[model samples]
Target: MPNIDATVTIPADATFDNTLQALRRSPLDFVSNLVQTHDDDIVRLPFGTQDIYLLNHPDFIRDVFVTKSSYFAKRKDISAEGSYLQQMSGVLPLFEGQLSTTYAPIMTEAAVNAHMRWDTMHQQRDFLKVDIYKEVMQITLDIVFKTLFKVDMQAKAADLVDAIITMDVGYGFDPIAALLNDLAPPVTVSMTSEAQAAHSYLLNFMLGLVEASRSAPLDSRSLFSWLLKQQVNGQPISDEQIADQALKIIFSMHEVTATTLSWVWYLLAEYPNVEAQLHTELTNILAGRTPTFEDLPYLPYTEMVLKEVRRLYPSVWIVGRFVRDNISFGRYLVPAGSIVVFSQYLMHRDHRYFVDPDQFDPLRWTQEAQAARPEFSYFPFSAGPRQCAGRDFAPTKDALVLATLAQHWQARLAPNQTLEPYPQKSFTPRYGIQMTLHRR
Candidate 1:
């Protein structure tokens, strides 16, 4: 359209520097403001040749993540400049297609349907519902354990609960590994004690996981085991490959699931009416019992709530890609090598598609309402090929956790404490959310 290759330089002046500073201070709010301020699909950053193109509009998002997905691949390494932050959150080289193919059946809508049926009829016994946030966190941890290690770490759960609490602690925010991933081989830090500590901790932890998996007998259910059994033209996966994949799975699952659950409680507390309606739906459907996969079809309200939470606070809020070649979509062309971002936070909040976009209304997800909107307008887990591999399991687990906890308890935010959303590893509460659980 309008000179696709025409690019402008973003200087290291106050405008650019201050913006970066603001982002470091409050990334989510900063990005939200960025979305509102910039109209250009792509803006050149002082950072480098890799421009920051905002993919907030659904039409544009569909073009980037779905329609023209093959044109973009996950950025080889995220940050252009060297920083500790980018390393921690960089693209992980995990087994992609095989992992997706293996888990697809288990995480499918049908599998969810079957699991819910079994859960509702038989498996909900002895299940005293805990706080929804705690329950989801536990379930994610369980899933990670089963899928990654093929073993439940719960035998040591109580002790290990805090062990991995801040597993990514060494690299501050995004981690240096994520930043320098595509650069030269991993380098040692000589600057701060913090950096050194983080490097040591993560390296050791990864090494241990690798050693344990290698020594242990293979288990079919675990992801590591699945990888071990696989041969790429009769060659086994390398130790480094195994460790990297394991780290990716662990990091992705824990932070995202925990943060999503945190927002779930926050939203439920903010909207008493929605909570009441959700309770009514769950109670009417399950009749004072835990929800199962079968009840998912009947539990639209629960699904809506989870969808709403995701809309407001997507675990993987931003999808990043580096363009491999110039691509034309709609009226514009995104040149090769541009760093494109498709943001769920921006897309979900855009006024173009949603009515009263800022408000959190779960009812919009009702079959009738959803049917009325553009298909690509709703994408918390993204859309198309590179959409989250774990997207399918996330909602079912969220629904189960929410329904189970809501069945017996109502959790309320602690008095006089204001909790705001901020992006750390995931969408975490800027200040930790304190809640007092009242038994219902």
Candidate 2:
């Protein structure tokens, strides 16, 4: 641990500026290069006046999120507007009890319904050229919206897509933009007028859902109902608060689940051997039916593939946390109020933890293999109190979605398109994941 207290700064000059430009252009490549170039546990990046500490070492990351989790808090008011580009923590599910179980059937029906729609389209064209990004995002939106709110907004699905695109429109420049413009909001570009409009549309949509849930039966399973019924402090979560949080859930769930599923399809296309094993697991497990909660346990390989996909292309690449007072992790002391980041993308690929780090090998996710590693080394949904509230829901939902489609349809990458990961808030394919569908 050579001089852990000391730091290296990438200035606003040519070398560092070029990297910053690359970061804005291709964050996946930028940060990968940053980690490779720094080759140190902690790297200091200067974005105007704000100092960013990129903590790469697993132990250091553990200290930040778990071992000393209380020493850090989610950054408040990172952006002047727009839900921290849909990454803020307070606006999402607080993990009440057994949400995945309560929501499982809705999740299954949504996946099956998505397949039926594809099947209908496929009847007309032998091989449908579908954009996995769009389709998956739409399906997850349907799952979240319909399951929780008990309403269909299919007419506005296009608007939701627009919202996702525009909300994500300027994310890459957030770090630099925040600094230069004195916005100081990490990891988000300023909201565009278009994005603001879309945000308003979603808020209005969710507000309507909140109102509907107020009169909903006490036995209803809608998440909006759940939110309305619960009392925070002494009173129930407000309608405005409900609307704000509903939009946050809508933004986070649809984007993350959709992007992960899209990457799963892309990876399946690139690695046939892995795909074969996955299909075999589905075949032996489900035979020829849509997967549900019961079938998830037996479909271990399918879960492994999803795990591997998340490892390679995490839905959330990095999360921001404010350091609390004096903190000592190993030999380094991260001062309070400094912005520190721990990236799953970096740790998932760290050589010390993974062999053939870049390879998409699902077998590496075996129980024994997982048990051998440090707890924080592979936190795709994050860890500690701030860990994803949807942890149970996302995995089961992802496995079911993967199995539902992979069981009957084989989606291949469209030959002519450039299939590069877009490095968005989630790892989205830049050109969209265009695939030629084939019956399994």
Per-model TM-score on C-alpha atoms:
0.75, 0.83
Question: Model 1: C-alpha RMSD to truth?
Answer: 7.3
In terms of TM-score, how similar is model 1 to the real structure?
A: 0.75
Top model by TM-score, which number?
Answer: 2
Residue-by-residue lDDT tens digits, candidate 1, 340-422:
66567777776777889878899888788888877777776666655665566666656666677677666677667666665
The sequence of per-residue lDDT tens digits that candidate 2 reaches over residues 1-440 is 46755444543452445655765666666667767876567766764445667788778877776788777766444343223424324324433343556567767777888788889999997579888888888778877776556687765776687677666663333633322223233454466677778778778878887777677664345566556765556787789898997786787677677878889898899999999998887888889887777887898898899899999999888777766576765566667667677678888998888999999999988999998887778888877766776777678778878888888888888877887765545677766878888887
Model 1: weakest 10-residue lDDT segment is 84-93
C-alpha lDDT (0 to 100) for residue 65 of candidate 1? 70
Best by lDDT: 2
